[model samples]
Target: MVSAAYRRVNGGHDLAESNIVIYTHPTCEICVTVKMELDEQGKAYEEIDLAEFPERWSEVEELADGDRITPVTVENGEVTIGYHGIGCMFYD
Candidate 1:
């Protein structure tokens, strides 16, 4: 069963099952914006803050192919680094 928070955002879909993950940092404006967009779209995602979880920084680095950046979005095995004016690849 999907969690109550996940259900509220994704219409009863389990976010973990979807495998949507976002890598972010606390001071990044782009990260904040991307998070807002995700919330607005009602998409459930797992946000990993590098500041809070330093161990996950390597994961983001690998996903971004060594480019250390914030707001790295991963959805269903697809990785998107950086915000390009719109939302994540799975936004729509």
Candidate 2:
């Protein structure tokens, strides 16, 4: 069994059956780096351009507590604000 928090985020969306959401801009350097890593590791993810889906921006803001959230990486249900030191590993 998993903890309540873990269950809520679906184990950081690391579960094989879980789907990861990547909020990124194609021109973002950090997003590019993270995407490279994911590609190298053969990880699966779904990209949602914040520029295109402004509505989802509210969801991201809610999860991040209104922080300057970008390239928000979410696995399962867990939320990540940025892409500096953190990457897909948090979920893995």
Candidate 3:
């Protein structure tokens, strides 16, 4: 059974199924790098282009703790504000 906190984070989202959600822009270098890494690992993801859906920026902001950072990723409800570089930069 999932913990209460995890369930709360899940919030009716299918992150329990391992679906990853990436908020990105096509021209974002860090976004590209993150996608490439995920591709190399054969991980599947759903990408939402902020450039195309400006309305979703608020959601990104929410996930990023009010920071307007690109490439906000939500995997199983774990929010990652930016690409976790090889040196562990830009990540929580």
Question: Per-prediction TM-score, please?
Answer: 0.72, 0.63, 0.70
- lDDT of candidates 1 onward, in order: 0.66, 0.57, 0.64
Candidate 1's TM-score: 0.72
Give lDDT tens digits, candidate 3, residues 1-92.
32222211222234443468877766678887777777777776767776776677778778767766777878776878786632112322
In the range 1-92, model 2's lDDT, one tens digit per residue, is: 32222212222323354376777654567776665666666666766665565556566667776654567877767776777654221110
lDDT of 1 by residue, 43-64 (tens): 7777776767766667766886
Give residue 39's lDDT in candidate 2 (0 to 100): 61
Clashes of 3: 0
Candidate 1 deviation (Cα RMSD): 8.3
Candidate 1 vs 3: which has more TM-score? 1
Q: Residue 49 error for model 2, in Å? A: 0.3
Each candidate's clash count: 0, 1, 0
Instruction: Give stretches of model 3 more than 4 Å off.
Output: 1-18, 85-92
- Can you give the lDDT of residue 14 in candidate 3? 43
| Top-TM-score structure, candidate number | 1
Q: Which stretches of candidate 2 lie over 4 Å from their true place?
A: 1-18, 85-92
* Better by TM-score, candidate 2 or 1: 1
